[model samples]
Target chain A: MAKKAVQKAATPARRASDAGRAARIEGGAVVVTGICGRLGRRLARQLHRERPVIGLDRREFVGKPKDIEHHSIDVRRKKARELFRRPDIAALIHLGVMHDPRLGAEEHHTWNVIAFQKLLEYVERYQIPKLVLLSSANVYGPRPDNPQFISEDAPLLGANRFSDIRDLIELDMLAQSFFWRNPGTETVILRPAHILGTVQNAPSNYLRLKVVPTLLGFDPMMQVVHQDDVVRAVRLALRPGVRGIFNIAGPPPVALSRAVKLLGRPTLPIPHAVARAGVERLWRWHMTSFPAPELDFIRYVCMVDDRRAREVLGYGPKFDLGSTLRAVDEERWV
Target chain B: MPARTALARIGDVAADDVLPFMGRLWGGARRSVDELAVRVLGSDFEERARLLQARYAEAGGDPFGLDLETAKYAVMTCAFFHRLWFRAEVRGLENVPQGRVLLIANHSGQIPIDGAMIGTSLFLDLEPPRVIRAMVEKWSQTLPFVSTFFSRVGQVVGVPENARRLLEMGEALLVFPEGTRGISKPFTQRYQLQEFGTGFMRLAIETNTPIVPVAVVGAEEQYVNLGNLKWAARALRMPVFPVIPQVFVPFGQMPLPTKYLIHFGEPLHVQGDADEDDAVMEEKVHLVKQTIQSMINRGLKQRTSLFF
Candidate 1:
């Protein structure tokens, strides 16, 4: 599937008085954390068209600084004043944090939640008008019998450390957004399911050993969102009045078995107990020293109800599961 | 409701009421039959005779008085020929009112024999025989043999307009919100409820009719898909492979006669008053679907004997 640009068509300029008010302001700048990541790079590029985007990351992208400004900063280090010295930073997109489950509970708690708390404080200190936070669908846990697609109103069971941290971050974001009670400085928390798309020179969480090796023949019934959809959702979140958590996933849930079949790769169904034991052995051997919490987390299927994304945000994916799987198989990057 | 007339009440009694007194007469009659045929028939002749009598009662055939001759003939021919021997257990039968109510059950199985069995139970066991008008898919209307029988039995064609029309006339209508997708799910996805369309809720709200939740087990295990022919299905405009079960043909694509259990949960009363909120009604409908699915899962867990 061809990736459609997330940039909305330009509308007529504001009236003379409004234009004059806008002109009085200096350069409008947006701060994007983890801009070196797959989704972060797309968001930076899209936002840079209208505003000067500052890409903040601990690592560097291949061809990033050629057009946009890149800043190396760790969000957890309380370098708020140093990072916010750029006078034109009007909005903040918090995408930085450790997503690897190999990181233990304490590390994840400190990086994902504690760092987010500090970042939220820094955003408020800098008085950024808008904030877009990325969340995950892991909060819903597994519900095999729930054919209703696990709506937002469904009970959440965060059985692992990663999801528990995610839940806390979401709670904090919601609390602060409603604290000042200013709808103008809105906050959009997007809970996206497993995202599958091309990432140059980087191993994706989805493409890791646990899921990839598990994909023998038939795809497990899991939901995956394309990278472009994530970028589109971020752009939509930048628009005014798009608040609250939106479950963004592909058009329909794709089975992992079906996805492997689409890739024309054979899949072997390893029993859940056997898979768990294998991961434990890998951890003991220190072949990859990431914490096994995420493996434990993936054991519980993650599926979300995308009704709100369709009904409210006017956001829907261009491709269904079949097409998305084909694109992933072909390694097409947008 | 007033008491039935004395003659009518007496006629409503089962023929088995006089079995003890007439046992010797029937026993002698059976002995006069050919010895070879009797030996081949085995020892369940009495049970078979009782089943025929029940089927006759189901078809509105009375075994007493002047109607006995016609009833006996019907039993000897059609009833015996259509004899369906399968174990069935019904739950929440007490919640079904004797009036015109809307019955909504999950749809599965290629021919939807579950619907026929439920109709049989209602006609035979209910205090007053009730006719269950079910909404069948438009595709079924194009199939040979099925379309005519459905129409003859007063089944409504499953279109939005037809459904509303049936509800307008205050007829008991059965509909499967999952439609064709529910039935076509492979054995791997059996017993899991598919996404239910909101048409039933909309119709219930529009007509202010009560929606009774129903769950049927044993239908899914009847047909297990060994493999799906995707190209063939696409050419035929079908979504799944035609299933081949172990019972029907041993190795061919035919369905097995698995024992069935149909459980009807309590009726969710959609308020008839015009002032009922739409959101509240939708929530109630969702709760009803959830309740029925839970009941189904619970019943399935309790069923230890699937082979019988």
Candidate 2:
């Protein structure tokens, strides 16, 4: 039998427009690992509005949320090549890994650092155009007389155990970003101060125990970023060519005492050192026995200067510390 | 007793009254002082005698005992900015307490010359001069003249222990709550308040001291951060990328002589007894921070031009 001649036909104008729209969607498609988590969900929802979103989590999605497509896969166990077989992933927001604050240094190194390294290698091998990695302000250790404003250039002293973990992760991210940038792939790192907002199904986890208590007139002071701001920054990062680490924090910083006052709650002002010691003791006794370390979530003084975000990423916080707390108290998300 | 009496009587004798009579009797200078020297030791020796007489007269002209070494050093250091005409217009100096007040200002510029200028203004302009001990960063202690001079002038490292020690001693202390971060922030984020560390509050509460918030304008524009060299920072173990600026180039690595206005706000008194409740103390600290930030915002707003 003779081979059938396949004539190359020009796409119709209407079809061309459809293809163009499809191409844009494909270009903006983002693969978010760990979309089941609070932060991951928020990011997924935010990014889905602008692009096609594929959420990969270890747990299967019985029914997917609006606009988000889901896949069941453990990032640690699966190979990236096998996982991203579709080849149309324009960006990857790696939000996976067991971020258990209760984990020890060794466990954290294995789960966060070691797993992150493997992910970076995958990102590089796949030649992903953009990667947005979320970091925390914990990289900058606590100091009593720390400057009221911490810029990106502020010292990364990694004083405590948790800070050390964050510091290692930040270094890995930076190294990865540099590696990709050198090869023409763009990477954006966001060091959000303290993530605050609501999530469903999950227990009142890090935000409730660590952040909410402090904001409600506890002894500690913390800088916060609203969920909206965090999501918005991530969305902006999805646009091609945005690179560099930006500190995404709220407007200024509020004392836990002040936040409590605003919340119409009575505050107890124990000495910072005493409070920290108590929390550390509690973690040692019970919290760390879990898969994740609880004390890692309780750090109260993680602050950073978000000048770079304001200047470069065009990021301004929609909610300050006061508003963020009010939303939480009202259970806005739930 | 007799020797004491004789010494007292001699002290009472006027040297001026004795000098005229003694000069006439010693009128060998009437033996033509120059002529006598020339005849006794030849013409060459006369020139030497003339030089000696001129030196003796110059030494006798001002007999006040002034330690020239210390005076010279002071003048030299004071003249650091002498090459550039400094036009400092300080406002709200009255807000500064006369004795033992804590001066809290934002830290900026590569080197904290604003603190030095404020100290100098206090000593020179205020009556009954007061000394200022700035609570500086520990890293500053490594710099050559800065560490020694700061030590000599009673500048303490801004550690909690040092701050407590200074407050307990009833000395005026200057603290920049923003520390290195405030001064070193990229030029893009100017005049924004950083997260005020709690040390100032803890110190104030512990010592029951009042804080005088200071707003310094015109310092931010002094040395703009044109760019940051990240690789160099990593290589050198430096915290931030080294800032490149127009002022820090070629000869005389000095910041531009930007006009400075140090505005002082009213003192914030942490009320209640020394043993006030912790919540009350924290409230006071927050109020003070807000007050200072308000003052700074106002000052920045009121300025006609950073250039002027």
Using TM-score, give the best candidate's number: 1
Error of 1 at A77 (Å): 5.1
Name the weakest run of 10 consecutive residues (lDDT summed) in model 1 chain B.
B62-71
* Model 2 TM-score, 2 decimals: 0.48
Which run of 10 residues does model 1 chain A get worst, by summed lDDT? A1-10
Candidate 1: tens digits of C-alpha lDDT, residues B29-62: 6776545334433344335545644644464331
Residue A92 in candidate 1 has what lDDT? 73
lDDT score at residue A141, model 1, on the 0-100 scale: 53
Q: A82-134 in candidate 2: lDDT tens per residue? A: 65545677777877645555546677677666667766767777766667777
TM-score of each: 0.52, 0.48
Q: How far off is residue B100 in model 2, in Å?
A: 23
Full-model lDDT, candidate 1: 0.60
Q: What share of the reference contacts survives in each candidate?
A: 0.00, 0.02
Tens-place lDDT per residue, model 1, A1-334, is 0011111111234244334323422246778888888778877777777778887787776567466888677776656556775556666777775555555667777767766777677766765656777766666654322222455545445453445345345543453454345333456667777676664311233443333555122122457777778788877776654556678887554445445666666655654556657767887888654444454333333567676877767788877665665545444443
Task: Work out how many backbone clashes candidate 1 has.
Answer: 12
lDDT of 2 by residue, B11-99 (tens): 66646666667787688567785564344333443243344235323543111111223222442354244213345666777777755
DockQ values, each candidate: 0.02, 0.02
lDDT of model 2, residue B58: 54
